[model samples]
Target: MRIRKKRSLLNQAAGGDGLRRVVRKAYGVFRREGLAGIKTRIAWLRAGAPGTVDPRRYGEWVRCFDQIDDATRAVIRERVANFENPPRISVVMPVYNPNPQWLAQAIESIRAQLYPHWELCIADDVSTDPAIRPLLDRHASADARIKVAFREKNGHISAASNTALGLATGAWVALFDHDDVLPEHALYCVADAIQRNPEIRMIYSDEDKIDESGKRREPYFKCDWNPDLFLSQNMFSHLGVFQKDLLDEVGGFREGYEGSQDYDLALRCAERAGGGAIHHIPRVLYHWRVHAESTASGTDAKPYAVVAGERALNDHLDRTGIRGTAEFELNGYRVRYALPDPAPLVSLIIPTRNEPELVRECIKSIVDKTTYRNFEIIVVDSGSGDPATLGSIASLEHDEVVRVLRDDRPFNFSAWCNSAIEASNGDIVGLIDNGIEVITPGWLSEMVSIALQPGVGAVGAKVLYPNDTVQHAGFALGLLGMAGRVHHHLPRGSFGYFGRASLRCTVSAVSAACMIVRKSVYRDTAGLNEKDTSMAFSDVDFCIRVREAGYRNVWTPYAELYHHESATRRDDSDLAMQARFDKEVQYMRTRWGSLLRDDPFYSPNLTFDEENFGLAWPPRVGALV
Candidate 1:
């Protein structure tokens, strides 16, 4: 080993070719990943790759890819000149007592835009600071596009925003903060996306936080138009844009939700323009200034924002007629859906081979710990030779809620599940593995509430290993060319990556180990694929089919359960099993091409290396379009 190290140093030291190779490799990483990506590669060589990449270093990323050179300005100008009535965006900013330098920088960022079809409308909320009005007047005098409105009385954010909205004449309105900065190409990108997707009425982009020294950090590379996640947190806070008609339709923000005025406005607009009318640009367009008072520093800075956000979310739920209560937890909101008048009967189907102890624990936990009153257990045993296990199964039938199915057939998991569903007498069917045990008493309640929703297909839980580490949060497709668990191996109660693991967001698929689905929809979507995926990939395939049938599969971190997955897991070293696994992979690729490769809930900026929401080394997206 010592000689190899010595030879390596000597080879690089002998000629410039070796050093050139090192520089060339770094340059390649820059083209793929940004400037921080070079440091990521070095860290991997020094201490091995981290479980998740440190997604900071926003300054490096901006310099590497988001640089607006003269050539970029020329392109923007040429593109705008050729357009037919390219949108003139009206940026409305609500102001109070802000730092003078920061306010000047915010106004200057608007003046330096490459896309010239924009107007700035500023409304001052009776600031006590004397510097506010003079600075505003200087800017209004300098540029014909800048509009300033000084409020006579002290109104809050919502009222101030509406005052600024009254001065706007453009077709679209872009929400802005008094101290925040927009990139030179921000308006250009929004206009470009509008031109491409003419039906879209609302749009937002990724954002980051800038400190007093103008250093950027904490970049938030967000997903594409996630409605559930939008309820939890206001991802549309920065770079949030809307059509003037939609803004007017929502009545231009309510006065009560002062701190979370944007969130409330977004919810109302989302109700009007559902999923089909919104677009997301995967680029950092807005920079929120971080200081002692800004929420970007931490939520503790503004406790009122959290409370107002909850109120806004609860009001959104009521407006949509969803019978659910929203509560703030883990830095996001969790909605507890109410069960129907006659609580839907849940039939939990547990398939076992010959494991008696595991089966007994599973059944005992459901009977002892589960708080849900109306449910039954159906144990499907296939060819169990142990007489003692058979005797215990027969004895379990003495209880009215426990039913035993004696099916002495081949070990086909999919076939057993379908047969169990056929024999079950309930409105909802839960496909639970025999090795899983209940951790939370309200586990059944959470799953039933979500699965009982109209368009929701499969509802999964937060499963943990016996050691209290995460076993499965959900399924992320394109993980090593197949599906893998999201937030796998995270310690219990870990709020991963912008609190995604803690939020009930949409997923492409979920594990069958602990999932619940409505019986009517399950049968209509054609329950698991039994022929080609009898053993493996059946759950993912079933979920894909369900999504194709216009039903969304959901995964929640609220329902906690202990999954002894290793006990039921089998090694794939045998040639026959390996061949079958390869065939299933090929079948999935041929059947679902892009959908498997790209998950809507998962970002292209995140890596599939560990499926743990790490920043992709050279993200799938590039600079502004």
Candidate 2:
């Protein structure tokens, strides 16, 4: 005869009192059957009988029973008797037509781990292979930590990942894939990182790519934990241990990102994480399988990967409220900002001695191309004896937009700038050389954005030579005898050693040729030092004071301008220019001392060897060609 378990306690009650009889009946049922039989009977009873209990609470109880077996129950009771905590972890893997041998290898890798405090939850999309079920069963039988759930229907990678994530139960969740191999120390590394930095929400490490025969590949893209690079590209290996709370907060892996889910996750995590919350392990703990089907192979085969990357970038910008246009082309890989609505007031200060044509071109460009609306021009005439230079300033049709300040005391660039600043009413102060010609629209917007960042004291533009070669990418002091030198002269498109068109580095000073400074910093710095005002070392001195006061001086390649070198100060006698240059170098050497002598960016060896000034500046020969 087929035996059926009681569907409800009320039906098995032996007495009239419902509560007391229910307890007695439960005890009798447990006594009559073995643990497995009782579990089967309980499963049947719950299926057949409905309860009015809260669904959430009842579901929790159901999950507890589902995870428990006869041996586990006894162990739990013993642990409770002895007062011990249970080990918990949630291993989430999303599979799509996974190879049986590779899947088995992945499972075996998990089984071989020293820390056996984990559970494996696999979300398998529908596959046509007949060997999958038997293979899964063979592994599941060997270990209770392994659990497999086959979807009734086929889902994409994102949906499959979410399905696996839904089954997590541990305090932490680990992301794993079907074909990847984890080192024996993988779990231990994660545990150690988490233990050290408990406040960190996620941890990732470097990974090696192995071929089909398990041979390591050449030229690996080593993982970097830089947040800036992370936003631009996926520099972190994906197999990371994430806190369950942070995972839930981000709503798990976003769908529709077929191959770039990890990239998307890294960007989102960086956006939400506070300072230093995301961490990196400098060792390779995960082995990525580099087969033909891998996403990193190329975008041609997996076009969706490129799409996903673009989508991730767009989403990051949208979420962060960063307003700029993203350009991904060669020589144009930068985000240029559109002019802000009701643009902030700017005061354009130009110190002129006797350059009429260049100053007129500069003013015309500002009036013609500048999309920014509110701004005034302050021309500090530092003893311009040329009648045409004075006439150009007097010839402005809009006199209301232009103000001329006469400086008859001396030709001090610093003091002239101070006079201009005193005459200006704008919050942002721009100092442009009389020899510069603005070449781009929205140049002011780009400058303003960098200056507006907290703690940023100044922003300078990318000044190019009249021959179209880069003149000054940015300025770095102590680089070449404490004199500020331009960064990239590499034949147009080279990224140089810094891996950027405009390299980001801490500099002793930026040039005052075309720079933007906040009004408050100008006030604080006392408007530059006039002690050495033959225009010799004033910019360097100002930048030093700015840094000493704890402010960052930035150089951006976003704003482009053409510099007519030394148009106002005619030191055309090569000896005079050389003498002036030597004096400035001497001043820097005396001020900075051993710091200038030890700069890595400068090279005495190349300076002696190379005739090319370009190669001599960077100290590395043949790198810029």
Candidate 3:
């Protein structure tokens, strides 16, 4: 029988969508060939594996290959031969009834580390398997670096981890599962990061999974320290190393959060050591092992793990004084922040020309679907040539909360939005296009919650096309010269690279079609620039200025809206329109040239030619300063 692919198993485990799924189809492949099969597969991967989703990553690995060559190993040894202050890393391993074969592989991976300054602290939680205790004893006797402790009773994973933590004598402790494997240069990478940034207290690296056949796939190329994304899910699960002092300060891992103990510990550590103390090493250093009973195969392996994770997140929020509640959504969590008391009014501004049908739908969705009560609509109509549009505009006058203002000048989207802003009276303002329709009922509430957060300048919602394809998720600067949406045209319900399309991560900017900005922040940043009469890049310019004023612009997938984008606007195919667009693009390049070249939220290793989030042709090297 032909072997099944890893993706099929992942889809089955994730119920057709696997943001956190690990590869599990290699068991039969590994069993058939044994050790020879594992070696052959890795060799094939180095030779540019066909049908690989991320070929660039494999290509990079082939070049480096964790200093396997004698010459490369010598160079690495020379570099760290006489380090001034080398920090010892304590590997905390909590073991139960792990597969003997896989368990040996895990221990061997640590023994193969290039970095010499480390110790493996293993706590066996009373394994029923008779082979486990003898194996631990043999390894500890052979290697002085290996320390073993046998539990008197079968404590859960949290207690077992705490027991291992007690054995840690190093300044930093790194979490390692008994069944998982580590790269040869994992500790070396950690040491290098520490050498570069000595102040780092918490460090995490990107990771992937190894199938039973030793086929490495499904790499998660994560972003830098993303607090918003952390609240949603445990992005820093693998290769997490924390200062032992910081862990002690947080009182170690809580007992009840068994399956998600690492996530809970990470959150607690983050609460104590923030900003520069938190660091990210964007490289796959850990390889999770996926088996039938492993949590990597499915969350259902430990049903209570999901519940415990939610409780951990809620506790983090309460301790941090963030007024919100976290609830489970698929394989992740969605945080619903409680709206401020006497909710600040949000002025919804829509710029329209004639298109009566589009404008009507936009207004209807806002009135009927929006659940946020403290909001007023301001319609800025620009020279309605059709009498039907005039009637539609006059009809809204009867609604006391909706105000229809006129901009009799030529069609300039920026000027129209500015006019509406001046005429509106609300604590917050939303610049929405006339062709947008609300999809999520709690859209306004989600936007308001984020907008009202401290140091947040603007909040952008996920805008999808009428046919359920993504119109705009968030903007990445330097993409297509000025900026472009990260996951534009991606199918709905599909998460983009590393679940970035679904998670609430920060972006350089977001489209103003359905953006909410605080009135104070808008005034502080001087609102939208009206200089670009063609109206292109106006929203990007506004967001950049907002960030320059020391505020973060955020994009949330929770607040969703269907955007009939460009429905009312004239096509830029004509010579005159194309010339205006060129001018607008040129104006943006002139004003923010340096910023357009580099976007902090986006990684340098990613492609700028397209928004596919694929690895660049020549991946960036060295540490990000």
TM-score of each: 0.89, 0.59, 0.86
Over 191-252, each residue of candidate 1 has an lDDT whose tens digit, in order, gives 99998899999999988888899977777778887766787788777899999999988799
lDDT of 3 by residue, 92-162 (tens): 99999999888899999999988889999999999999999999999999899999999999989999999
Which residue pairs clash in candidate 2? none
lDDT string, candidate 2, 1-625, tens digits: 0122122223232224535744564564455333533453343333331112233533353354222355644543443344234335577888776777788878887886545667888888876788887787788788888888888888788888888888888877888888877765566556656655778877776555556776543212222344333444465554677777888888888987776787777677767774367766644567777777875443333445654666777777777777754433111124444455767789999877776666777787787766566888887777878787688766753567777887876545777888789879999999888777766555677788767765678777777666655666655444444554544443332333223334333344567888899999988877787654346667777776786687767666557677887545535466865676577656666776655543322333223232122223222212100
The regions of model 3 sitting more than 4 angstroms off are 1-68, 383-391, 409-411, 532-534, 567-571, 574-577, 590-600, 623-625
Alpha carbon lDDT of residue 218, candidate 3? 66
- On the 0 to 100 scale, the lDDT of residue 231 in model 3 is 81
Model 3 CA lDDT for position 511: 90
Report the CA-based lDDT of candidate 3 relative to the real structure. 0.80
The runs of at least 3 residues in candidate 1 whose Cα sits more than 4 Å from the true structure, single-residue gaps closed, are 1-59, 566-571
Model 1 lDDT on a 0 to 1 scale: 0.82
